[model samples]
Target: MSKKPIKRLAFENLTIEFGDKKIVDNCSFEFPLNRKIRMLFNNDVNKYAVLHAFTQVEGITQGKYFFNEDDVTQFSFEEFMSYRLNMGIGFSTRGLLHNRSLQENLLLPLMYHKMMSMDEALEHLKKFYEYFDISSVKDRRPAEVGPNMQKATLLIRAFIHEPEIVFLDNPEMLLSKGLYANLLQLIDDQVEKGNLKHLFFSTEDEDLSDCIADGFIIVKKNKFEFVENKKQMRLAV
Candidate 1:
């Protein structure tokens, strides 16, 4: 028997389109494992489309998405579900269920995946709520909480299960200075503990990106360009 090659999280000859427009044209890049990557885009629409495609929240026009040697684009329902179990994604907006309480929203993934019991999930979430200072709004529905609280919940939910790869779309939006600092700290802690092996985030804040990202992925002219050095990333920007 031959051992399968490890591709990790990667996109090969990927193309994404919106209607008649090609957002990403035959882009191929393997996301480096155990590193924080900042995704840069020329425009919001392109950013949205590419990010959605990366997370499989939207369909790709063409190409393959590989995760640990498996083609995610070819995954069946069961396969996709299994693939998603190793991923944690935080959307910029409308990520939570409107009818569900904040606590419920954060707890669903952990419980549904059967990663832990209800008690264990809640107990696990307690620290996050405290750290993000959203404990008071836990029982409130998404509509009832402020944007910061809602965003905090979504961010917490992403890492709640300690998935191998985390995709955060515009993670800094609607967060306070203190809360944002706390978020960075949380990420540092997670990485240090070896719980989060890969993190890809799109943020409009260049300073934040420069401060945290180990590398840069620039999405422009329907292509994905990788920059491993901070100086090169700045020049690319």
Candidate 2:
């Protein structure tokens, strides 16, 4: 058997502020690798705020972030890009490029990351297309494809390079339950095969708490807390 990848991530007294208001305040938690985590938020704003902070859309005002035992707390966006390619972020693809073909949208990332050449990217795309049964619309632009296809494209782009950690933002809102289940299965397979070490999915649905494999994180009264039950989370919310 192959040894599993070690891609540990931790937040030590992490805080993010928007002017006078603090979005994430003094949050401290370490996400366990080789497990699935559900990130529950009190509201949509909080959901987006946490995701943005992780993706560096906003700045961290305090504390340290450790990845693979290294303090990357002060790393800039450019620094993150040259780092281990440890993280991947996914959002709804409804607003994908209208001018570029779907294939181009997916191929560009592979090429930019130096993961594959044009011919290699095309071959990789073909495999994913066949796996998702999206080959028919592979050449079409985003606007021409249906919602399901768009969601598939987005997911493929997110996981094509097989990053150690993946951050999914409101995927349930973008894909149907069937698609969501498939996505979950994909993550599970990756985890089992040691291809993915951690998966963090953020959402506002209280019911999603049941899907937590290793507990869930929630924003309670503007503070991030990890919990096991939705009822207790409701009290904090």
Q: For model 2, state the Cα shift of residue 168 in Å.
A: 0.9
TM-score of each: 0.91, 0.82
Q: In candidate 1, what are the lDDT values of residues 64-106, reduced to their tens digit?
A: 8887777878777675776677678998877899999999998
Q: Candidates' lDDT values, in order?
A: 0.80, 0.68
lDDT of 2: 0.68
What would the TM-score be for candidate 1 when compared with the true structure? Answer: 0.91
RMSD of each: 3.3, 3.8
**What TM-score does prediction 2 earn?**
0.82
